[model samples]
Target: MGEVGLRTVRDGQRVLRFQAAVIGAATSQRGSSPRWSELVVYRMVDGHYLISKIGRSTVAHQPTCLRVNHRMVPWSKAAAFGEDSVQRVPCPDCRPELGHGIAPDTMLEVTRYRAILCQTAESAAESLMGDRAALLMPQIVQTVLAQCSESDPNFSRYAEADTALPRAWENTTRTP
Candidate 1:
């Protein structure tokens, strides 16, 4: 462990710097094992601390291990020692427990998917139904337009169609 003595600060606080290097157990079943995280704790504004950050740190999510009496300790056990005993939370960006998988799509992505579905349906109607696809244009438009007060945000992206939307609809709507 190392500490950099007090230095001048913008707010004039004697920021103490300490470092701990921790070797984490390999958490991944497939990817490379968990990498080393070096953590450095900066003093709190009013000396508020959480018993989380301690060792070789990364971002908040990949925070340092907890410590006791200027000695590093495991996070789970350190929490029992209470706030006064703890030092600081991790980077807050580091989320070690969260599994790494395909990031879940946001509502905006869902809306885009809905638009894609609409485009696909339009293509199928024109290709398979031919002249009858004309009759379905108004129905499709109405169905899209009539959705009001609905929880689905899909229409928000769907309705903002390109100017060619109605022209395409008209082309598909004409009777044989």
Candidate 2:
């Protein structure tokens, strides 16, 4: 998350900060359930569906990125990543492509997601579990960034250094 050409380097750093700030805000928003999120699904073949993505309403609908247009469906019909061996490519522009959710047709998938929800959020009251739950988020992001760099170093270089990530890390927006 770096320069988007629409803002200065400082503002671009605020981009990711906005996300972390928003999530913290949700945890404290009154009347918000312990674990509630917008589950966007895409219709797959054979009456099956894939959980194309998941996030807060603002994240999906009125977003600065990851935008999509679609009709709604019941969460009961959602399926996890790689579930049922079903693979349907998601839309590229909107990018609602993340395969993971609970489905009514498969109790096993439901149970798996349930367990994941619990381990990550069920014990949010405990605090420490919450700390450990998302330990891999940055690592995963780094992995994705690395893959992108391998594919297109000149473009992906921005994702790695086009921000003042730390006082030490240089914000290299230019390609060599």
Question: In order, how many clashes per candidate?
Answer: 20, 2
Q: Give the TM-score of candidate 2.
A: 0.20
- For each candidate, the alpha-carbon lDDT, in order, equals 0.25, 0.25
Best-fitting candidate, scored by TM-score: 2
TM-score of each: 0.14, 0.20
Q: By summed lDDT, which 10 consecutive residues of candidate 2 come out lowest? A: 16-25
Worst 10 residues of 1 by lDDT: 106-115
CA deviation > 4 Å runs, candidate 1: 1-136, 139-141, 160-176
Q: Which stretches of candidate 2 lie over 4 Å from their true place?
A: 1-137, 156-176
Candidate 1 TM-score, true structure as reference: 0.14
- How many angstroms is residue 29 displaced in model 1 relative to the true structure, after the best TM-score fit? 57
Per-residue lDDT value at 91 in model 1: 32
| Candidate 2: residue 108 Cα off by (Å) | 12
